[model samples]
Target: MLIGYTRVSTDDQHLDNQRSALRAAGCQRIYEEKISGAKRARPELNKLLDHMREGDVLVATRLDRLALATRDLLELAEILNRAGVGLRSLGEPWADTTSPSGKMVLTVFSGIAEFERSLIAERTTAGRLAAKSKGIRFGRPPKLSAEQIALGHRLSSEGTSVREVARMLNCHHATLYRAIGTYITPADSN
Candidate 1:
């Protein structure tokens, strides 16, 4: 059985071409959806996958119709393969998992995808380090400014309770303790 899956990203796009191509390619049952390939959730695609059984071949008009990323495509292929089902793309004949050469091609593509992911990770780490060296702070800004912290220290030194100072600053007492540090006396620790 050749089960077909077709998708269109938006209302403006139509599934007619893909449906026709899949039909011409001998698809027995076609599942259609109007959703972006970037989205992980596709009801029709999920249904089609659930409906497939051993020896069934999952077919699509093109590789991109199934998934936008190579990693996603490879994941889908792995799921289908694990279920004893094959995957085929009408646009890319070399993508047929039912054939030996096609499996080899997909294997090579899988390796390339992994290498690409590693390169992207390395580049991202390096970029983040460079940004940090340039004093580009990430994440949320501190709740208290340097002046506010200094004021907190002064208040703690003046025998003001940590709770009272935190209340004045509109923050938690723990926040005052962290900012004022050693300025908080034994009595203030309570």
Candidate 2:
């Protein structure tokens, strides 16, 4: 028996591709869901897992569609492995659990996914550092400019409290404070 599982992260995501592929693969029973991969509340997926029997094969369009975390994949695979069930992924050429070589392939696939994730993290960190060196701010732009900042400093120095300065500037006190914090020189504050 071949059972298929299809998942879409959002309702807007189309399941046509997965369903078509699974149908072509001769899956008699198809389970589907429109929920986030990050969530653990997949009743359909759970039911499918519970319904699988020995000699049954579970099929999915992609390994990622089945589980978001590597731990999740491992746990699910362990369940299937223990139950004498098999898993087949249409997208992953190596994810066929019917043969010894395929089992080795799944192990290697997990390692590659882990390595790829680490490389992505490293590249993201390097990109952030590069942007910082070039003085390109990463987050949201500051509300105040140099002129407003200078005015905020001057107003605060002239015995005007933060509250008064913010009221006069028609902005929030926190915004004014943050703007002031950006330009406050250590020696000048002393």
Candidate 3:
């Protein structure tokens, strides 16, 4: 049995071309989804895997359509191999896992992909460290400005109700409390 799998990254993309090709390839069953290949879980692919039996062939239009990551592809291949199922890619002849040469090619590709990912991660970390050293801040900005915090502290010291001060500053009482620290007692703050 030749089982096909088709995938598109988003709903805006059509699966017609892949489906047509899979059909032309004489696929009796085809599983498809419109979701990012980066995602770890794919329901349709899982279903196909569960449905596949020994001596079956899992076919995809392209290697990327089947899996975006080398680890994921290798894991899928392992599962198929364990089930005595073969894998074939219509676009990449070197991706056929049924042949020894194809398997060797896939192993080399996986190694290259892993190395590429590590390099990307290393560069990203280096970039982040450089930016941080240059005083570049990341994540959400502070809710209250320095001036507002100073004003809040002054208002709290002057015995004004925290709620009233928060209202005057157009901020939540909790925000005022966080900015002003524990300056106001709970009874007076709330």
Candidate 4:
């Protein structure tokens, strides 16, 4: 069985062309969807996958219509392979997983994709390290400054309630406690 999957990024786009192409390529059952390839959850695509069985081939008009990312495409191929199903793209004839040459091409492509991901991760780590070395801070800035922290400590020592001090400083009581290194006990509060 040659099952077909068709998708469009938006409702404005039509799936007619893809459907015709898949039909011409001998697709027995066609699943249509109007959703972005970037989205992870595609109901029609999932349904089509679920409907496929061993010895069946999933056909798409183009590789991009199936998945926008190389990782995603490779993952789908892996799932099909595990289930004894094959994947075929009319636009990218070399992407047919039913043939030996196509499988070899997919393997090579997956290796290249993995290498590209590793390179991206390495570059990101290096960029973050360089930024840190240049005194660039990440995450939220401290709510209380050094002077504010000192004032919080003094206020806590002087029998002011943690909540009162926090209210005066316009911060949370927990923030004031962290700044002062103490949580004023209820017995000590005025």
Q: What would the TM-scores of all predictions be? A: 0.76, 0.56, 0.60, 0.76
- Could you give me the TM-score of model 1 versus the true structure? 0.76
- Residue pairs with colliding backbones in model 1 are none
Q: Model 2 lDDT vs. the true structure?
A: 0.88
Top-lDDT candidate index:
4
Model 1 stretches with alpha carbons more than 4 Å out: 24-26, 50-55, 79-84, 157-159, 181-190
Q: Model 1, 101: alpha-carbon shift in Å?
A: 1.5
Q: What is the lDDT of residue 47 in candidate 2?
A: 97
- The residue-level lDDT of candidate 3 at 190 comes to 79
Across 30-90, the per-residue lDDT of candidate 1 in tens digits comes to: 9999999999889999999899999999998899999998889999999998999999988
**Residue 25: error of model 3 in Å?**
5.3
Worst 10 residues of 1 by lDDT: 180-189
lDDT of each residue in 28-144, candidate 3, tens digit only: 999999999999799999999999999999999998998897778988888998899999999999889889998888778768877988999999999999999999999989777
State which candidate, 2 or 4, has the greater TM-score. 4
lDDT for each of the candidates? 0.90, 0.88, 0.90, 0.91
Clashes of 2: 0
For TM-score, the strongest prediction is 4
Clashing pairs in 4: none
